[model samples]
Target: MHIHFIAIGGAVMHNLAISLAEQGHQVSGSDDQIVEPSKARLKKANLLPEQVGWFPEKITEDIDAVILGMHADINNPELVEAQRLGIRIYSFPEFIHEFCVNKTRVVIAGTYGKTTIMSMVMHVLKTLDRAFDYVIGAQLEGFDSLVKLTATSKIILIEGDEYYASPVDHRSKFHLFDPNISLISGVEWNDSRTNISKEDYVNLFETFIETIVPKGTLIYNKESTILREIVEQTFDCKINRHGYKMPEYSINKGVTYLHDGDYRIPLQVFGKFNLSNIAGAYTLCEWLGVKRDDFYKAIASFKSSIRYLEFVASVNGSVVYQDFLFSPYKLRTSIHAVKEQFPCQGLVTIMELNPYDVINENFLPQYASSMDESDHAVVLVNKESIKDKNIVLDDLEQDIKRVFKHKDFVFLTDLDALEGYLESFKSLGFNLLFMVSPKHNTMNIVSFADKFFKNF
Candidate 1:
């Protein structure tokens, strides 16, 4: 098979290209911009385009399929050419569904912890030598790529995203998977452009549940009242429902241990949220016929996904962490996790208003008390980003101030100013918690912190 990826520089697109290439399919791809990791990985696979920009001439009928990325606009020349030539074009999710159609699809969906939970499932399965393929959002520690597809694998684990599949396909990416087994980590309204109203935002998941095959399972976090209500109202009887509560546990000397009756297993990862993720992973593995004893042993070796709560450095008595938190629910959960882990420390939480949903004036109020758990909060928003997105900064700031109700909290528009503020407080011995989505400014927080803390 021959596959050509349009806008292949995307995180998922590049991985899919490599997966196909590794599967002995002739693969070629073109993108306007190819950044690090993706660029280097494509180069290593000898799949990177000789030239960066798309070429209509490259989209010949000889190509078996053209995988379109969400990054590619509807007006993309190669996409247009592919359509003109009557070539089949599949969105990334659509292509993945085609590959896993025969396999038992295990789709993990949520507003938060999807990547971590997916990674956990993959890790446990891999350790057990289970023949499975998977598509995860982030790069895992031992995984060669973000995606893997093979003829022999009987199961395919997918980190289900709620974002629009493509410019032409407005349906949520998760909807395409049509899962035989699914898990909803939690739900919070996200993707501003796709889901406008609260009801509309939630209806997607309801529809997702409805799509499950008969005798399939839908495992969900029992803590989310809204999600549970949706399941009760919409899920069909054939779809077996399972609910999970946060496992009983305690952290001793910075190490987290899950206590299930008399059994005690120490975990490499910290936080109540991660503990819950592990519980959900264990339950899913058990449902897949993994023995409880084997599940615990395999999970004991598990490390967390990158950037979920990655440690930066510990200077003096204060430590700093970089967390991938964007949604209001994630913000609240992450803050609570950090504070609970270090109760004696003064928590200084800094988050970048980077997501389109969080930056939009209409959505700012949704995050009103998201950071209330933190002792000191700093909200950072890039002014240029707000202007480019046509969002009002005053509206965001006003709502944040009203919701946080913390006089010590400060809102800043400049990264340099935020860095300066951190530098000045170097001697304050405060534990720093930085949360942001993948944005131009948020991506640099680690570099800034490294430089600032090294000198301090």
Candidate 2:
């Protein structure tokens, strides 16, 4: 089979291209820009495009299929050529579903904890010698690729998201995946980029509920009132619903332990959201034929993904940690988790907001009291992000101050000012918690951590 990717430099697209190429298919791709890891990985797989720009000649009649990435525009030349040639086009999800239609599909979806939960499931399965293919958003430890598809695997675990599948396909990505086993971590609308109202966002999950295969299983976070109501009100759907919450756990000396009767299991990952994710993963694995004891044993050694509460450096009692937390709910929970783990130290949190949140007026109220747990909170608002978005910096800062209940709040837009602020904390001996996301142009967090904590 011959396959071509329109925008192959995407995080998932490049991985999928390599996987398919390795599977004995002739895979080719084109992208305007390709970055470090993707470029290196694709080169290793012998799948990197010879040229960066798209060429209509590459989209030939011999191509069996063209997989379109979300990064590509609707008017992409390659996509236009594919359409003109009457070639079958697929979104990555659609192509994934094509190969996984006969397999047992498990799709994990929700507002939060999707990546952690899916990673836990993948970790336990791999430990137990289970043969399965998967598509996850994060790069977990020991996993070589973020996307995997094989003919022999009987089960496929996918990290499903409620975002547009592609520029051409307006359907939500999760809607394309009809899962035999589904899990919804929880539903809290915070995606201002989608420009959808709260009710409309919730409706996406309600529609996703309808997509579950009949008589299949659904594992959900019952703690979410909105999600629970949506599951209950969907009268036409036929599925077995299993609701899970945070399991019994305790933090001792900064280590988390899960309790089961008289046996106590120590975990490398901490936080209530993670504990809940473990519970959901355990439930799903149980249905997949893993015994409770075996699942617990394998999961005891499971570590958090690199971007989740990852330890960076430790100096005496003060430590620096990095996390990919930006949403209001996640921000509040992560702040509390770090503070709870180290009750004796003062936590100084540096949070960077996404550009979508900077322009949206409705997102400010949701951030109220989100950073209350941190002793000192710094919010980085990139000045360039608000350039054409019609945002007033002074008004935005004042509104943030008014809404957020942090007593020691600092609104900083300059990276130099942020560095100086962080330097001032060195003498104060406060633990640093960096909550950042991708596309953060304000500061290079990992570099800063290494240079600042070099001696520590």
Candidate 3:
């Protein structure tokens, strides 16, 4: 099979290209901007585009299929040419569905913890020496690529994202994946370009449940009332609802210990949210025929994905960590997780409202009081971003202040001011947390911390 990718520089797009190339499929791709990691990885695999821009000549009918990435615009020249030539174009999610149609597809979906849960299950499977294909959102420790597909693998674990599949496809990406085994971490709407109303946001997950294959199982977070209601009222699949009301666990001196009736296993990762994710992963593994003992053994060594609670530096008892958290629910969960781990320390939380949904004026209220759990909270937003998005800065700050209900909490639009404020802070044995999505500009914080705490 011959496959060509339009806008293949995307993180997932590049991985899919390499996965197919490794599978012995003749693969070629073109992108307007091929950036780091993707560029280097594709070069190493001999799949990087010779040129940066798209070429209509590259869209020949000889290609078996053309995979379109969300990064590519609808009016992309190669895409237009592909359509003119009557060539089939598959959205990234659609192409994934094509490959896993015959396999037992296990999709993990939610605004948060999907990647972690998928990684956990994949790690367990790999430890068991199970031959399976997978496509997780983040890079795992041992995995060379974010995607792996094979003709012989009978199962595929995918991190199902709810964002749009393509500019032409208005449906959520997860809707394209008809999973035999599905898990919904929780419902927290995002990607404001697609989801306009809260009801519409909730409906997307319902649609995912309705799209499940016959006799398939849905493992959902019963803790989310919205998800529970949607699954109960809308879904007819064999539902196995799981919640956060599991056995108690605690963190002791940076180590997490889980209690399972008579068994207690020490975990390398800490936090209650992570514990819930572990429970969700455990349920999925059990459904996949992994015994309890084996699951525990694999999870004991799990060190979470990169940039999700990743350690940045430590200076005089002040530790700084960065996480890929942007949505209100995720922000609250991450803050609580840090507070739980370092309850005695003064927690300084910095959040970047860079996502389109979070920066929008209409969605500002959803973030109200999301950071109340932190001892000291600061909201960071680029003023130019507000102007670019056509959102009012005063309106955003008012809503944020109202939600936070703290007079000491600061909101800064200038990077220099934020940097100065952070540098001015005296060492107070506090834990500093910086949270934002990958698309946000956070390298400044990383750079500042690296320079200030070089010796530490």
Candidate 4:
């Protein structure tokens, strides 16, 4: 098969191109710009386009398929040429579904925790020598790529995103998976960039529930009132439903252990929210025929990357962590978990306020008291991003201070100033917590932490 990728510079897009290329498909790709990791990976696979920009000449009718990336605009030259030539164009999700049509698709969907839950399931399955395909949002440790496809794998675990599938496909990405087994870790109204209303956001999950195949299994977070209500209202007698909450666990000396009756399974991860994700992952794996004892043994070594409140480094006994937290409920849950994990340490949290949060009038109010658990809360604001979004930063600092209601709240627009502020905390012995999304163009928290604590 021959595949040409439009806007293949994306993290996931490039990986998919490489995976297909490795599978002996003729793969070629183009992008306006390509950065490290993706660029290097593509070059390594000999799939990197000689030139950076799209070329209509490359989109010949002979090409088997054109995988359109979210980064590509609807009028992208290659996409336009493909349309004119009547060549099939598919979004990543659409292509994934078509490629794995015969396999049992297991989708993990929610506003948050889905990535971690999906990672957990993949890790456990891989540990037990199970064969499966998967597509995840973020890169995970021990995984070669974010996307994988196989000819013989009987199951495909997908990290179902509620966001649009592609620039041309406005439908929710999860809507395309049509999973045989699905899990909704939790649902919350979020992503000001999406402009999806609270009601619409809830409706997205409801629609996702409807996408499950007949007699499929749905594992959901019973603790979430909104998700529970949706499950009840969307009840399908043919669909088997299994609800889960935070399972029995004990934290000793900042380490979390999952309790399976008399046996204690120690984990490399921690936090109440993570515990709940574990329960969700455990339920899904058990349903997939993994024995309870084997599941516990394999999951004992599971360590999520910093994308989910994982530790990065320790500086003079002060720990530094990066997490995927943005929504109000997630903000509160993550902040409380970190505080609870290290009750003795002074917590200094730095959260990035993206352009969406800066521009949306309702976004800031949702974060009220969300950072109350932190000893010092700092908001990282990119002045350039605000300017690019055509938003005035008038009174944003004051607005955040007033909304958080924290006595020690601050917002920094300059990276140097933010770094200096963090340096000041060295003497204060405060543990650093970065609650920001990696998708946003900002300083690499992991790289910065490693460099900052190089001596330590």
Which structure among the candidates has the greatest lDDT? 2
Task: Give the lDDT ranking, best first.
Answer: 2, 4, 1, 3
Backbone clashes, each candidate: 0, 0, 1, 0
Which model is ahead, 2 or 4, in terms of TM-score? Answer: 2
lDDT assessment of candidate 2: 0.87
lDDT per residue, candidate 3, 1-456, as tens digits? 889999899999999998889878999989999999999999999998888998999888799899999889999999999999988889988999988889999999986778888888888899889999998887888898889889999999989987889978878889998899999887765555443688888878888988888778888777767777787776455655445444478677766689998778998777666788888999989889999999999889887776677678777767788887656777888888888887777888888777475455676777777888888888887776657676677877776788678646998877787777777776466778888767766446677665434432
In TM-score terms, candidate 4 sits at: 0.90
- After superposing candidate 2 on the true structure, give the runs of residues whose Cα lies further than 4 Å from its correct spot: 191-193, 384-399, 426-429, 438-441, 450-456
Give the alpha-carbon lDDT of every model.
0.83, 0.87, 0.81, 0.85
Superposition-based RMSD of candidate 2 using all C-alpha atoms, in angstroms: 2.5
Provide the global lDDT of candidate 3 against the true structure: 0.81
lDDT of each residue in 1-456, candidate 4, tens digit only: 899999899999998998898889999889999999998898889888899897899988789999999999988988989999999999999999999999999999987788889888998999999999999888888998999998989999999988889999999999998899999998766566457678888889899999999999999999988899899879754699999989888777777778878988898888888899899999999999999999999999998763778788886777888887667777777788878887887887888876677777877788899898889888889786776676545677778788889888888887888777655555335577888865774867876676445443
TM-scores vs. true structure, each candidate:
0.87, 0.91, 0.87, 0.90
Between which residue pairs do clashes occur in model 1? none
- Which of the two, 1 or 3, has more lDDT? 1
**Which pairs clash inside model 3?**
369-403
Candidate 2 clash figure, as a count: 0
Please identify model 4 stretches exceeding 4 Å from their true place. Answer: 191-193, 382-396, 410-413, 426-429, 441-456
- The per-residue C-alpha lDDT of model 2 at residue 386 equals 69
Q: Write the per-residue lDDT of candidate 1 for residues 234-352, one digit (tens) a residue.
A: 75457899999899988776667889899989887777778888878987887788998898899998877577777777777677887876667778888888888778777888887
Pick the winner on TM-score between candidates 1 and 2. Answer: 2
